[model samples]
Target: MAVNTVGYTSQITAGFRAVELAHNKKPIIVDHLAQHLAGAALHTALADYQQLQQAQGPGRSLRVPARNRIMDDFVLEALQLLQQQQQQQLDGDGVVQVVHIGCGMDTKPWRLQPLLHVHWFEIDQPAVMQLKQQLLQQAGAATATAPEPGGADLGSTTAGSSTASLAQTAAASDGRSCVAPAAADHEQQQHQQGVRFPLLPQRYSAVPADLAMVPLAACLQAAGFQQQRPTVWVAEALLYYLPLDVACELLRSMRALSGAGSCLAATCIDAELQQAHLRLPSQHYFSTNKVAWHFSMDELAAAIGAAGWRMQGQPQTAAQLARERYGRETYVALYGGAECCFTAVPG
Candidate 1:
């Protein structure tokens, strides 16, 4: 079946752009798996990406480096905090769940070491999900017999170390603490349901759903998501594409599905940036990507707060944070405070 990427082509391009930025050795934000995942669909945005890469020169895109730093830092920080919470819960049933809403070609399950123990649910359009599964299977097949790329054996056990070790520790503490058996069984069931990827970590599952059409909470429950556990909802570069009401509804649904201590980490293009794009000549690749920016920083934070999450850190411009985190030497032009990333927890 031909893949339909209608309103989602920008996601593909963003992944490819990140891959190119990584290739240029500009402060790596994405990992090898993410780069590979992005490359899998390079054909979709090859012309535009290549044109931009060549026109701007390698590692010199106007906004990519800053954007990557901001987005990656927010996700990594949130996952680190979530990992700490998961570690504390390890003495109990300690299984943290992560739901990546609109996870198009996302490679976090493999890239983020902490996520190895996470029950990762990647939700996206049916076609995007299917395509990602296909790509993962091919990649998995190629790497099956080889040791995992980053020198960590998938089966290794070390005390309080990696996810594999954490699982071992949990299983040793109590047989019921391990989520693998049930997750493996569920993985098999998902395979039968046509939402499975053979190469993905057993803890990872993909759910095919159009957030614009289906209720997010229902789809998540059908995928075996549990509300009682500590969940981290990631909506990177996702909410802005949605209409204001739909985006707000998604936040509300997430709030309803979350338990106490649940967290949300998200990135968005604010209204000011959207307006700037409109005022400028349509020359940049971003303008042609068809993304809709509907919220100002205050508006986004207010909506999220209304949905029952307490903002964690002060909202900062992507460029400012990127410069602070990575140093000014790697600085690129800021998108005029038009983009921001932040994290929040249940109020």
Candidate 2:
């Protein structure tokens, strides 16, 4: 069966929006690498974003800004919670493994590599994966050819230059030496053409799979994911695109695959928002035929608990988090009833 590209394309758009926000310096939530990975495709979305910004004036928009910020906050908080757990019980090798589901143009592995000894795996559609690999390869080439900072017009350099600079900066921040140029290039080449790219030094892996058709657990195991190791599973803004039963089944499978000390972090659409969107005369972000289901905070918690996991901390609402972080009255009016974020651990 042919997989619908709607959900996958939306994920890419979200990534593009994140890159836009990062460039504007409103809040440094997403990695700058997202901009590079998105390539020229981001220009259209960004142009729309700029128009929206202008229409709303200064710091307001038709819920776009609030939504983007909220999503970014959710991801940041989830990763932070995952890091806290890893810090408390790092393995003998001092490495943490994370699996990002439906990861479309996300730069978490690249951005977080320098901070921790992490083995990161990103699972997504084959098309998205292919495009990502190409962008990364182009980025590597650009980084290799670009002149060193202070010697040329840095603004004209490619995304590779930015990536290399980020890696070096991350290394410096952690009191470590930068990655060797030759090794970096080799690793990039190895992953560019294959399904499994063993990103050296950082240990990043990009696995192509469609969760609806294949067994996720089996795919991860084949990709070198260890069932006995403590793992962090991230499903950011992905569940709503799946049928309710399918989403629950995925959670159960994840629970079985996870060891005693593993954790899962995810985001879900609020029940009210889901219903409201369903009733709308026309859909904006998702096609009615594509979005199978959406879960409320309570529904999500129940699903997680049923899968043998314990919920940690209160469910974080996007609206509340935005209001707290941005302190704008408009947040209450725009995002007061949007989505939410949460974390869970094996019971």
Candidate 3:
């Protein structure tokens, strides 16, 4: 296989860093550095083999492409806005039911490491989940390896998070937190010292299933869905990959399995830009190879309504929508960062 599990695993993390960096995860170097490390690790066998067989050796290590950061920032801005818009609904219950449809190796879940009380579940292709599970293990192991929590904050989240396995949502979402002061500080120093990765967490299980074809509800049940109850499904950078029909079906199935007050959040582009706006030459964007169901924003929204969903209001203020998310400079750079979302409930 041209790409093995690690290679693909690196790609997955690259994808996450892309979203994070595009939105300006500064040092900026960190994302690029992480990308290259993951890419190298993923393709080590191929790269090493090529060096022996073909004198050319492997290509330059894959790091965060410089151009992507600036451009992706706008795109991420648009996406983060859409996400924040949908995430707003997770309130009052003292529980955050969360399911990340295509979650890569993002530490948000771990960083916001809910106390044991918080239940969390991540869904992705099986291989990808394998990587996630490893990362989560690394984190937990490191927690044990590192100095124990010094104050209320340290032991608080891990001990406090309420369980709601299906949604991956935690009980008390007071805010996002993870990584120790020493660890974060170590990472910062490592960057200054030009070291590779500061430290990574143990991987949690990111379930594997191609939801594009098979309905997820069934697989979910087997994976502890019934134990968790209502789910807050969040799909970031995933819908674009599925055919519209398939996308609609997933949402419908999620609703069918939902008990009450379940929420599903996703980000999609306005199909109108397919030929025009989305035609950017950037290799990082989710183009045809990655996205099977290209669509226009209007058509997507209409499709959602057709599927019985009502678009919820966003946290849009006086500023133009995209600008508010990533600022005017980035918004313009990223083609107004066109994206939208819906938070529909069963009536």
lDDT of 3 by residue, 189-215 (tens): 435654333332211223456565546
TM-score result, candidate 3: 0.53
Report the poorest 10 consecutive residues by lDDT, candidate 1. 153-162
TM-score to native of every candidate shown: 0.71, 0.68, 0.53
Candidate 2, 1-347: lDDT as tens digits: 12246434544554555545654545424444555565554665565556646655545322433544455454455455555665776454445567888877665554443334455677877666666666666665222221223332211122222233433433333222122245456456545655242343334456667677668875665454667756778877777777667788888888888865677877777777676656544434343554544666667776667767787788766556666777642222221356676777888
Estimate, for each residue in 46-158, the C-alpha lDDT of model 1 and write its tens digit: 55445656554555433443555566556667666766776776365566777888777666665454334556677778777666656566554221211223432222221
TM-score of predicted structure 1: 0.71
Cα RMSD, each candidate? 9.3, 10.1, 11.0
Candidate 1 vs candidate 2: which has greater lDDT?
1
Q: What is candidate 2's TM-score against the reference? A: 0.68
Itemize residue pairs with steric clashes in candidate 1.
Answer: none
Off by over 4 Å in 2: 1-19, 22-25, 39-44, 47-57, 60-91, 113-115, 141-201, 279-285, 323-337
Candidate 2 residue 3 Cα shift, in angstroms, is 9.3
The alpha-carbon root-mean-square deviation between model 1 and the true structure, to one decimal in Å, is 9.3
Off by over 4 Å in 3: 1-96, 113-116, 132-205, 212-214, 276-290, 314-337
